[model samples]
Target: GAGVSQSPSNKVTEKGKDVELRCDPISGHTALYWYRQSLGQGLEFLIYFQGNSAPDKSGLPSDRFSAERTGGSVSTLTIQRTQQEDSAVYLCASSLVAAYTDTQYFGPGTRLTVL
Candidate 1:
């Protein structure tokens, strides 16, 4: 399989709306991550998944943000009641294994806008 891929590379939504971002990790990768990058800022970790166990979701900004990985392959990040502050590029990455030193392959990211 190819590197991580995200759909709807760009999105625009009005305030209070909901949006879902998708991520497809590389085949056989056991660790997947989701991040958010604001304009001119570094990536901020949002959530992480390893195998099929519970996900590490401590980085989510608020209750409105959540994510899930199904079948240890594809993942989805959902933002409910979008706000202008939620506008940013959502990035996804995958690693061959779960290790602090593992190299992560990243997706291009989905740009979301809240109007």
Candidate 2:
């Protein structure tokens, strides 16, 4: 892909339903990241993956949230039993370099709404 690609640009679900968001990263990129942005909460890192290294999943809010990256490429984020507080935009990014300071290219996020 030229840049990251995210599916279902907008999703509206009743509270308690589960939702799955997908991300397709740029070609040859080795690092991928997931983030969430809310009304006032700026971008919050959700997870980080670099090649075969252990992923950083410390940012996930609860057991209801999970993600996985396969073959160092595509990734999926699943939220189970979504709540009203979970309504926000889920963003995905990728970078060629795997460092704290590396610049990442972001995808048009999947907007999740729980009502």
Candidate 3:
């Protein structure tokens, strides 16, 4: 795919269940970002991986959420204990450079539902 791609376009999970959302950034992109937004809320930054260095996880909402980028390309977001509040649209974006000024290409996002 030319653009960022996310798996399980929609997910329905029970409370306390774990969920793994996958994201494949554009080829050759050096930066990948993860974000989630609840209904009527703005996108909330979750994590980001730049190159082979450490990811900035400052934006994560809690310890239950974590993400990793393998081979500097594919990325996965893991939610340890799903909660109703965790329901949101998980979005992935990639940019050639990891900078605020770089244009980010975004995926359609994975819609999560918790019950």
The TM-score values for the models, in the order shown, are: 0.95, 0.93, 0.96
lDDT of 3 by residue, 1-115 (tens): 5789999899999999999999999999999999998999999998888975545889999999988888999999999989999999999999998987999999999999999
Residues 1-115, candidate 1: write the lDDT tens digits.
5789998899999999999999999999999999999999999998888976545778999999988888989999999999999999999999988798999999999999999
Q: Which of 2 and 3 is the better model by TM-score?
A: 3
TM-score of model 3 vs. true structure? 0.96
Clashing pairs in 3: none
- The models' CA-based lDDT, in order, is 0.92, 0.91, 0.92
| Candidate 1 least-lDDT 10 residues | 49-58
Candidate 1, which segments miss by more than 4 Å at Cα?
A: none
Model 3 residue 53 lDDT score: 56
Q: Quickly count the clashes in candidate 1.
A: 0
lDDT of 2 by residue, 86-105 (tens): 99999999999778787899
TM-score of 1: 0.95
lDDT of 1: 0.92
RMSD from true fold, candidate 3: 1.1
Candidates 1 and 2 compared by lDDT, better number: 1
